[model samples]
Target: MATTAVINGERLWSALMAMAEIGRTPAGGVRRLALSDEDRRARDLLVEWLREAGCAVRVDDLGNIYGRRDGDDAGATAVVCGSHLDTVPTGGRFDGVLGVLAALEAVRAMRDADLRTRRPVEVVCWTNEEGVRFAPAMLASGVVCGRFTVDEAHAARDQDGRTFGEELRR
Candidate 1:
């Protein structure tokens, strides 16, 4: 027989509900458009949660956030898992938020279990994934993967003529 690790569903649900309140709208949707103030609050909350889970958190030049859990081996490359925190103008609660929260929960669960691996684990929150404010989704991942240059991603502008780089610097 195979054994499966069970996560605390109640805790996960609570975290999800808390996050849903960040950019909540009267229409029962999220308004965390990429690079908006609401989006920053959402990111800040996630970073706080990641830190609470004992992960070292960092944000890249392009505003992609990474939370890393160290393993026994210091030299091994990290195993990365994550999704974006940004959302459309009126996105659903589960769209990208769920993935980010789920990754956070997994890291929290691992910490609670005192689990260690040979390689560090990283949870990432890619920026501008929705491309609602900026154009061309997956901007941060593209920059990280070398498909797009950092300058290109930074130069991307939103509907209001604000640059991605400018907002990221704020």
Candidate 2:
């Protein structure tokens, strides 16, 4: 395995700014709901940055974004970092976004430094972590880890009377 290089801080900051533009509220806050257009746009931006970072990206059945940096040991368990992209109606910046972006930046650093670890590294963005547009929080991770079934999460409704699945498809 090669030693990974340092991630470009400017690039990471740029990615954050780009993603923040989506669903930005008038008061410099984020108003993105789970599965809304803003959320989709933000996810898309993350996808682009992951690609730029040379990560092979995939979206899970639950819409979780995964960026992978393959390890030397293909059979070893992955080193995983998880966070959410979805934000509340008036959520401020630097909450969940920091975690997701930091993970991305770390992966970017590894690539830039040309370093590889024995275990694969994955940067994951759990869908609907905020639950602002739905009921409850932490849906994607809960469902993926078998903490909750898909049906149970889909049945959740937000304050506006919108179901999780419904809001997600919107």
Index of the highest-TM-score prediction = 1
Which window of 10 residues has the lowest lDDT sum in candidate 1? 1-10
Clash pairs, model 2 backbone: 2-115, 3-115, 4-113, 4-115, 5-113
Weakest ten-residue segment in model 2 by summed lDDT: 1-10
lDDT of 2 by residue, 81-102 (tens): 9588788788887668879999
Q: Quick one: RMSD of model 2? A: 1.8
lDDT by candidate, in order shown: 0.87, 0.83
Q: List the residue pairs that clash in candidate 1.
A: none
Q: Evaluate residue 104 in candidate 1 and report its C-alpha lDDT on the 0 to 100 scale.
A: 84
